[model samples]
Target: MSLGTRPAANAAERADNGAMVLPGRSHLRAQRAVKIGSLAFLILALSAATLLLGRYTVTIPDFFHIVAGADIPGASFIVMENRIPRVLIGILVGGAFGAAGAVFQTMLRNPLASPDIIGISYGASASAVFAIAFLGASGLALSGFAMAGALAVALAIYVISRRGSVAGYRLILVGIGFSAVLQAVVSFLLTRTDINVATDALAWLNGSLNSSNWDRVTVLSMALAVLAPAVVVLSRPLRGLELGDDAAAGLGVNVERSRLALIVTGVLLAAVATAAAGPVAFIAFLSGPIARRLLGGYRPLGTAALVGMVIVLAGDFAGANLIPGVSLPVGVITGVLGAPFLLWLLATANRSGQGG
Candidate 1:
């Protein structure tokens, strides 16, 4: 028999001998299942910790009772009114950032290409800051401004990066440069604003959950509810696009249209997140890479979202309780967490001669 026929006969013999699982495919499937299961468990555990551990901490029994519509003294309001909204918002914003970050990184084919890093977050922040400082806008109005700002910035990057078509490397470079400009605008606005306005703006810029409420939560939820599914629907096209525009086009994907759709969707996700939580630091930039590492480079949006949830919820809890007599913002904690990782990645990339 030929070599391929011999291998096929051996496999057939192995199967006849009661080896039910195919070695390579089954092993990969099992590994993925285990990874996904572990991620789900971690997210659930972290969520429980988020709900149970706080200043007005709720016991297991009372927490269940509160969920069951029981009127417990002091517990009901704290759980339902404050903690619930906070936790829910954390999940939504984190998921949105995570998914958006993954999409951006995948679309651009660069690990460093993320919303916060490439100027999308700054666009949202700058616009919202402008509204807060000058237009005296708050809440939903600020969210609108953020959305508009992000879209504008994304479009500008696309336009600038295009010679005949959008090039991933050029897009990233332009985005980084534009990000600097947006940051400067934010800084300039801060300096020119009144002290009180600037104080609120600074808190927003730092990305706090201090003002998380049902209204903001609902708004973000609706936005994600629309945008996330769209991202998923476009995921196949996105995967195709990753193989290069020419390959994607050959695969029956409209490369330009798909790219544009992805950019809009990603920007919208980032915008809503910034609107809700003031662009909580590094959740976007960190989630995709973390998930990629955990899942062996196959980017799953759900996994990325869960990673983001854990990061934000856990980070928020640590920021609130870990420090003595001081509560830092969630963004501060994430910034701290991500900075070291970024440096390490940079060093590693440099060592490998991958950083151009």
Candidate 2:
């Protein structure tokens, strides 16, 4: 009787333990679901706000009407050529910057490691500016020249940094140094150019959505459609990297290879974004931290992208309305917002002894 009683008691306890684990698992899953929902909602709200709150007010009904029928005269041109494409470009460029920044910071385990910090944006900016200022390239031609210049610089950085395989910290440091040089080069280029060319180049460097059209949208959409899948496929390896290099290696991850792949992807993302939007200022640097805060300790890549989209669209909208007479550059607004945040981050990193 006693033996039978012991077996029954053990069985009941085991069942209770299993039941407890189920709730724990359920809690984690629910948390993730909420996070996803919140991020999705935020992006949707910002996108809708972009379409609705512009100077040329188009309500939800009109927006849908334009979408449904292309024959609607002014509505068709306004929807297809203006608001729709501008918003699309905003989302693409913002998401690319945010995602690239997140990937760099997470991979390096350094919050300061982003595409702009790495000189990738400067590379693209320099090329784009030189082409416009000196070569007199404009329109579609300038974009191609810009892309080419950006890629060339990225390749140079990769080659220079790969001393016995590029370490994350080393690559970042090298990139910053390289970017400093590029900035000087940019300054010299602008100084040498004629006033008109210089003025035009400055505007391009500053960035704006005023020039966004269907063509810009088409180019960026293609890049995102391709890169988004690559990022998703690599998410597992990226997550594993957070567990420290040795642990990730123990789990059969090729740490160095993964790091290189991610860096290349990040460079491409930043390069493409810079070419399109002239490296819209704080979206890359601010997005990761903001997303992390919103998602409550989860490193939020998708959420960060959403936040970037919101930031760009909102900043551009505010720029349109802020001064009335002059259309402020999107980069100018983002710079003002991000500069303070960057200062705060530097201070925090120092306090934490993160060795940025």
Give the runs in model 2 whose Cα sits over 4 Å from its true position: 1-25, 70-76
- Please tell me which predicted candidate would have the highest lDDT against the true structure: 1
TM-score of each: 0.93, 0.89
Q: What TM-score, to 2 decimals, does candidate 2 have?
A: 0.89
User: In model 1, which runs have C-alpha deviations exceeding 4 angstroms?
Assistant: 1-21
Could you list the CA RMSD of all candidates, in the order they appear?
2.7, 2.8
Candidate 1 scores a C-alpha RMSD against the true structure in Å of: 2.7
Error of 2 at 198 (Å): 1.4
In the predicted model 2, the residue pairs found to clash are none
Find the candidate with the highest TM-score and give its number.
1
